[model samples]
Target: MIDTRRLRTLRAVADHRTVTAAAAALHLTPSAVSQQLVALEHEVGHRLLERDGRGVRLTAVGRILLGHTNEVLAQLERAGADIAAYTAGTAGEVKVASFATAIGLVVAPAMDTLRDKEPGIQVRVLDAEGDQSLTMVLDGAVDVAVAVEYRGAPGEDDLRLFRIPLYSEPFDIVLPRDHPLAAVPDHDGEAAPAPERDAEMPPTPEHDARTAPVDTSPASTHDPRALPVDTPPTPERDTRTLPVDTPPTPERDTRTLPVDTPPTSERGTRTLSVADLSGEIWIGPYPGNPCHDVIALACEHAGFTPEFAHSSDDFSAVVALAAAGAGVAMVPRLALRGTDLSGVVIRPVPGPKRRVFAAVRRGAERHPLLIPLLHALQDAATALRQAPSM
Candidate 1:
């Protein structure tokens, strides 16, 4: 019989594309990973990997074996889930991996619910990006993962995993409060009507933008006024003046703006198109982040590439950068919830929406911890859907 551990090592090598990376991810030495691969090949009586310049590539037999390995691993996962269900104990530790925002918007709330309802079950949360989280789930390093759909993410019907969709959220353009594009002009030259704000509430404080700490309390009932564009400008304020020409300071001009990009004009309306942001400097996620690809694709569709002046993996930091007048940003709506918007103006842009999902190794969907956890996520998503947008 093929050793499951060796098969796992093979999968890791294939997924990471390098033995060194695979070893790191598996928390094993490079020699150990190589030894496992050698053992796997001997057991199967086939050479599974071949040197491809600096890296190794899977042989034809290796690809065929991998397909079977995925099936066997998935079956093993299902068998474990079935046994756990049959044993009927609610006590177990479930490790969940997710991006920063989902931890705030979904996982944290679900954990709160689970704590109240099933104290016996312990949940461990790890902050990870979509692709990394999914890989962790497949590797059994995590019991489940909360991930977003991206260009290279696994399809919904992938046999090796089960995906339970949670929610879909559109990206919003965040601008500085003092930005010329923050408000639209009224028909008679007065400011456009502002979205209603709760006068009794105080402004949320600007916290460190790098971390999104989970708030266990229910979402605040008090809704802030929608993008406030109603404040009339003074006589000296020309609503049409663009901030783009503000001299590029060392801190602000991190990257050169695309040559063909147009300059921002004060002439646009409240409703924004992707094309309208062509000239603006952007604050975005670093390369390989799912949001980074979404932003890039959205810009490509709109006819220009975003000129990223600042890059951060943290959505909070991205928003903070925009609020500080560094650049505009496209942020996921869920990330914006419960965030401080004191100096920010959020407006909808026609672009890609992120689809969030709960992923597990195939057949683990019905595990006791996962079932209730899934329900809690659904409840949170429903509540957010019903609640008014920030």
Candidate 2:
């Protein structure tokens, strides 16, 4: 029988394409990784690796073994999950990997809820992006991964994984409060008027016009004429028209737009088009990050390529850079929640959206701890969906 650990080492080398890289990911010494590969070749009775220049390439026999290794590993995962489900207690740790913002938006809140409700189940979280986290889950390094949909992610029908969708959040344009596009035209340098304490401001005609569908194809440029510069002000209706102790109307409690959608602006409020930002420097994620791809694709759709002058994987840092007047940024709504917005104004933009999901190896969905964790995440997502815009 082949050793699973040696098979794992072989798979890691295949994924990373280099012994040194696979060694780093597996937390094994380069010599140890090499030893494992050698031992596995002897067990299999076939040569697996061939040195090409400084790197190694898998032989035809090695590729065949890798295919079986993937199936065997997936089967082992399912077996483990089944065993865990049937076990008496939920006292073990469930390792999780996720992007930075999701730690606050979903995982943290779920952990808080679980603290009192299921103290026996401890959750371990590691900061990782969508693709990396998924890879970790597949490799058994993590039990679950909270990830966002991005290019090259596995499809829904992928038999090797199970996915639970949490939410879909739109990207928002984050700019310095003092930026030319953020100011109300007629108000000059004065701050925009604040909404009344107990009133909901109705959407203006200009807002309606701005929300109209636009061509988002890669070859299209946002038409400047499509943006609304002036709109007639609508009267603010009092939300507290009922008796002091009366229950609020459903309209007052329901959200008509996303929780992070910008509030309706009054007359003379200027809507910005992507073309207007063509010359400004951008702050975004580094090249390997999923958000970086999303931003790049959105820019391509807008008929311009952004000059990314500052890059950070941390959304807070991106926002901070924009707030400091370093450059503008495009960020997911959840990333901005509870962040310091003192020098920034976040506005809605018609662009790409990210769909967040919780992923596990196939057949691990019913693990005892995972069920409660999923409930906690769902509760948090529902609350966040109903929350008012910041």
lDDT score for residue 287 of model 2 = 82
Candidate whose lDDT is highest: 1
In candidate 2 the C-alpha lDDT for residue 143 amounts to: 84
Clashing pairs in 2: none
lDDT, candidates in the order shown? 0.69, 0.68
Give all candidate RMSDs, comma-separated: 16.4, 13.1
| Tens-digit lDDT track of model 2 for 300-334 | 87789999999888888988899899999988765
The segments of candidate 1 whose C-alpha lies over 4 angstroms from its true place after superposition are: 186-190, 193-269, 388-390
Candidate 1 lDDT, tens digit per residue, 1-390?
889999889988988889998998889999999999999999999999998877798999999999998889876765676678679678888899998888887789889999998898899999998488998997779988999888889886576787665666667678887777676553346543322222111122332111121222342221111111114434544221111213223222111111111112221214467787898999999888988899899999989999998999888888789878999998875577666766676655544667787888766764666767766766665554444333
- Judged by whole-model lDDT over C-alpha atoms, candidate 1 comes out at 0.69
Q: Which stretch of 10 consecutive residues in model 1 shows the poorest summed lDDT?
A: 254-263
Off by over 4 Å in 2: 42-47, 50-54, 57-61, 129-132, 157-160, 183-275, 388-390
C-alpha root-mean-square deviation, candidate 1:
16.4
